[model samples]
Target: IDRLAPSVVTAALDAAGQGTAETRYLVAGAGTMASLAVRTLVERGVAPERIMLTNRTYQRAAEFVATFGVGAVRWESLDVELQAADVLISCTGATGVVFDRDRIARATQDGRPLTLVDLALPRDIAADVTSLPNATLIDMQVLAERAADSEVVSDVAAVRAIVDGEVGTFLAAKSASRVTPTVVALRGMAVEIVQSETERLEARLGDLSDVQRAEIRRALRRVSDKLLHQPTVRVQQLVDGPAGLTYADALADLFALDPSAVDRVSAVGEGATND
Candidate 1:
């Protein structure tokens, strides 16, 4: 409710006139809802000194001023506050009209617009206030309509779209990353084959010197590296594109990659992540 309520207030401000630097915000209640509304105003760059709080009791207004660092108004000075305020939000639980027609009309006499946000349950601002010129009233009905049609829903939809896009991007990245484990497994298989072949040659050549063994190992390693390089590079680039999964399958098949090795690598990675 806190997240959503402010957008309605801002929508009221947008539908009405955007205030000038001289605009004063008058909140006529000191309730929780009123606090949320004031917080919204402050977050939107409304200076604390430019905001005035009024209630039936002066202490309530004073408490709000102390806590929020805004100005305070007496109950009797509501009309003067109304006249000074460019934006008026009513959260008072008054059954009758708080800012009646006559006072509103008189307050807006200087041709300045007043944005009235009525967030009361029993309806603080009169329904007839809309008929008055230069008085833009955003009551429960308007706020409901705004919640349904404009700002709030639009913003949510926009954010949801961005989230969906990011999810798709993440899936693509995850798919591209799958090929890396396959590449590592293929390299491991090559090392096992090279070691087995070296062992066989050493047994056959029985009396070979350490230097001859090292030379043979170096030549075989170079051949294996050169043979794997092109395939690994091509697969990495293609893995970022549409047919990445198919390429991974093909690589596994072509290299006769051991599925157990990839699973072991994945298990190790999962263990590391858990730790």
Candidate 2:
């Protein structure tokens, strides 16, 4: 979901010929949505030096510049950046308009074409910004209308299908993570049992060779894998079903496994895999 929205924004920018050298892009937020927009712009061959970022929090704006900066200007001076920018993608979560008629007028006075994208729910750019000469405001509602008009019926359906598939994939991944702790706990129990039995057998058999120890380990591993195979597959299948998390929780509780452990394991796995 995070990745998809930015690609959409990039496609829009590419369609508008904003991915070129002559365009100067300014993004006014440091949040996830804004970050994604910035990332998209940078990825689609927009020169970093031609970009400027301004956030309410100076530190956040600086951090954004540091991470995605490349050639981006970390504007401690917001007004200066706004005045100089040719294209502005405003995704700020402000309650009121961040850029008004005066700002729009000033930006347009520079004689550069300005494309303002107000992606916020309660639009960050004032309605009057569009009235200014050379300033074109493209808000979310307008973008939606444009999309509906321009998109082919089949392409729209394809996008919807992609979104649905992504939603399902995310839910399945979450559900699979939910049951992973229980599986781990079960495997731990099996290993403990094996170790205890091995210790008991060691006393009876007296000193066993390294080869015997290796064979025992292999046998235990095979047994554990065989024991877990069916339940593991079942859990994976359940991930695609409704109430999968609930079923996973029930299974965990029934097995006396800790529910929080599932989240911990999932977090660790996600971190490890960079997902």
* Model 2, span 81-163: residue lDDT tens: 77777788887777578888897887679777788887654568888776777988776555555664454334434555765
**After aligning candidate 2 to the native by TM-score, how far in Å is the CA of 213 from where it should be?**
77
lDDT string, candidate 1, 19-125, tens digits: 66778899999887788878877877888999999999899999988788999989999998888888898988664677788888999999988888887665688
The TM-score obtained by model 1 is: 0.50
- Would you estimate the TM-scores of all the predictions? 0.50, 0.50
Q: Quote the positional error of residue 105 for candidate 2 in Å.
A: 0.8
Error of 1 at 67 (Å): 1.2
Model 1 spans > 4 angstroms off:
1-18, 149-275
